[model samples]
Target: MLSILIPTYNYVCVKLVTDLQQQAERLECPYEILVADDASEDAFKRENRKINGIPNCKYIELQENVGRSRIRNILGRLARYDFFLFLDCDGGIVNADFLARYKALLDKADVICGSILHPSKQPSPDVSLRYTYEKHAEHKFTAQKRMQHPYAMFRSFNFLISRSAFQACPFDETIRNYGYEDVMMGLALGRANVSVLHIDNPLMNEDIEKNAVFLHKTEESLRTLYVHRQKLGYCTGVLRLYGILQRMHLIFSILLLYRLLRRVIRRNLLGKRPSLGLFAFYKIGYYCNLAKERK
Candidate 1:
C-alpha cells in the first residue's frame, strides 16, 4: 500500500531501511523500501548494500550521479504502490509509529508533509552552526505554524504523496543542484491547487554538517536560487528585500557594505559561536553579490 523511497549520496542507509521494514511488518501492510545510491563512494556503497537483505527492500546503485532532482523522479517512476514516502538517507526514524501515523493519513490529503526535527541538545562544536540555526527557529516549524503557509513550508525531507499526484508534478530534473528542488515542488503543487496537510510527525534529522560544510552548502543553495530566480518568482524574503533595495537605488551600496564585511562575517560563521542574525545577513549579501555579478 506504500512505497518508501529514499535517495542517498555517500551515506549509509541500512539502519533506516531496517527500522522502517520492521514497522511495516508489525502493521501488516504491503510495503516496499527502495534506496537509490547516487554514485556514492565505494565505502558507502558497500555499507548500504546490506539493505538488500531486508525483505521487500532493494538497494539500487547508480554508476553516475543524476543529482537530487532526477534521482527522486526516477524513484517515483520505480514506485509500485499508490502512496510514496520520501525520506532523506541521513535521517532517522525517531518515533516507532512513524509509518503507522502516515498509514492512517493515507487519504487525508493529496500531499502530507511530516516535518523534520533537529537534536535537542547541541552536538559537537563543529556541527553547532546548523544545530543552532534549526533549534533557534524551532517554534516556526511546528505543525500549526507550517499549516498556515503549507506550500511555502513544504519540505521533501519527509513526506507522503499519491502516485497520481507525484506524476502530475514531479521534481524538475533540470535543477541539478543541492537546493530549492523542494521549494520548486511545493510551488508547483500549490499552483495546481493540490491539497497539502501538515502533521506533527517529524523525522529525526541526524546528519548535521560542520560549520564550514554548512556554510558552503548554504552558498550552494543561494546560487541555485539566484540561477532560477525568474522561475521561482522571487518568493523568498531575501529576494523581496533585493527588490525593495533596487527600487531605492541601494543595491550597489548594500553590495559594497557586504564586500567590506564579508571576511568578518565568514570568520564568525565558521567559528563555534555563530549568530543567526549574521547568517541571514551573509545570505542576503551573498545573494546580492550573485545578482551584481550577473549584471
Candidate 2:
C-alpha cells in the first residue's frame, strides 16, 4: 500500500534499511522499500548493495549522478503503490511505530511531513553546526506550530506523499543543486492548495557532516536561493534582504562587507560551537557576494 523511496549518495543504507524493514514487517502491510544510489563511489555502492538481501527492499544504482531532484523523481516512478514515503538514506528510525503512524494518516493527509531529530546528547565538535541548527530551529515544534506556515514548514527529507499528489507537483529538476528543492516542493504544493500535514513520527538524523562541510553546503543552498528567486517567490528574511539590496542596487557595498568578514565568518562557523545568528549573517552575506560574482 506504501512505497518507501530513498535516494542516496556515497552513504551506506544497510542499517537504515534493516530497521525500516523490521518496522514494515511488523505492520504486515503491502509495502516496498527502494534505495536509489546516485552514482556513488564503488566502495559505498558495494556496501549499500546489501539492501537487496533484505526482504521487501531493492537497491538500484544509476550510471550517472542526476543531482537530488531528478533522482527522487526517478524513485517515485519506480514506486508501484499509491502512497510514496520519501526518506533520506541517512535517516535513523527512532519510532518503531513510524510506518504504522503514517498508515493511519493515509485516509486524511495527502502530503504529510514527518519530523527529524538529531541525537539528544551532544555530538562531536566537527559536526556540531548541523545538530545545533536543527535542534534550535527545525526541531522546536509539531503540527500545531507548523500548520500556521504549512508551506514554509514542508520538508522533503521524511514525508509521505501520494503518487497522484506528487505527479501533480514534482520536485523542480531545473534546480540542479543540493538544497531548497524541498522548499520549492512546498511552494508547488501551496500553489496546488495542498497543506503539508505534520506528525510525531520522527526520524533521527544520525549522519552529521563536519562543521566546515556543512557550512559550505549551506553557502551553496543560499546561492541557489538567490539564483532561483523568481521560482521561490516566498519571502524569507534573507530573500527579503536580497530583494532590498537589488532594489537599492547596493550589492557591491554588501559584497565589500562580505569580503572583509569572509575570513572571520569562516573561522567562527568552522569552530566547535558556531552561532546560528552569525551563520544567518554569514549566509546572507555569502549570497550577496555570490549574486555579485554572477553579475
Candidate 3:
C-alpha cells in the first residue's frame, strides 16, 4: 500500500511514470502513481497526459500554477495509500529495485529520505556548477553522515513518508518560491518528533540547469530563506554568518569587498571553470545585498 506521488512542471514524465509503474507491478502490491502537472507548457502537458494510459497511474493537470509547496500538498491529499513516495518529475529511476527498497523500510521509521545522486559522468564545463556542487558535496550526503544530522540533511527530491506524518507536517504552503522548503519540512518534522530513517536509495538527478540558470535559482532560494528567516527559526550557514557579521559591525566591510569583487565573481561563476570558493562568497554578498536593499 504505497502511493508514488510526482509533481511536474514544464517537464515530460511519461517515461518516469512508466518505469515506476513497472517497478510497482513487480512488487505485486497495491500502489497508485499520481502525477500532478502544475500548469506546464502545452507540449509537456500533452506528453505527460499519456501517463493515464499506464496501469495503476493517473495524471492530473492544474488550471493554474500552484507553486511548488502547494503542488506536493495537493498530491499528498490525493494519495490513497498508507505510505507516500514523493519523487521529482525529472528524476530517473536508475535502480529497478527503487520501489522495493522503499517498501522494505516502510515500517522502519515515520519518514525515509532516499536521497539524490548526480550523474557519475560529469557534464561539460558550460553546465557544471550544479554538478560540481553536488559531486563535491556527495560525501556529506552519505547515509552515515546524514544520520548524524538527519533533520538538516533531509532532502525532498526523493523521500518516503507515512500519510499520517505528511498530513501532520505538510510543506509550508506560504513558501511560493524555490528554496528551503525541504529545510522547513525537516524542521517541522523534527518539531513533530517524527522518526526519520536515512537510506542509500537514490534517484539520479536527470536535469541539471546551466550555470547561469542555476546561479539565478540559487539567488532566488537565498531570497526565499531571507524572506522567511523569522518563520524558519533555523540558522543556515549563510544566516549564521550574516548574523555574526551584523553583530560584529563588519557588515559594511563585507559589503564593500563584495561590491568590489561582484563582477569578478560573476565572471568566474559564468565561465568554464568556476571557483566554488568564490561561489560561496557570491552567495554571502548576494544575500547581504538583499538585506541592504531592504534597509
> By lDDT, who's the top model here?
1
Q: List the residue pairs that clash in candidate 1.
A: none
Give the clashing residue pairs of candidate 3, or none.
none
Against the reference, the lDDT scores of all candidates come to 0.92, 0.87, 0.91
Better candidate number, 2 or 3, judged by lDDT: 3
Residue 110 lDDT (model 3): 91
Q: What residue pairs clash in candidate 2, if any at all?
A: none
**Model 2 ranges with Cα > 4 A deviation:** 245-253
Q: For residues 175-283, what per-residue lDDT tens digits would candidate 2 score against the true structure?
A: 8887889888888898998756887778888788888789879888887888798788745668888788889988778788888988987888888878898888788
What's the CA RMSD for each of the models? 0.8, 1.6, 0.9
Between prediction 1 and prediction 2, the one with superior lDDT is 1
Q: Write candidate 3's Cα lDDT for 1-295 as tens digits.
A: 9999999999998999999998899998899999999999999999888998998999999999999999999999999999999999999988889999999888899999997889887778868788888888899899989999988888899999999999999999999998999999999998899999999998999889899999999999999988998977544889988988889998888899999999999999988888899999999999898999987
lDDT of 1 at 88: 96
State each candidate's clash count. 0, 0, 0
Q: Tens-digit lDDT track for model 1 on 170-283?
A: 998989988899999999999989999999998898899999999999999999998888888867877888898889998888889899999999999998899898999899
Give all TM-scores, in the order shown. 0.98, 0.95, 0.98
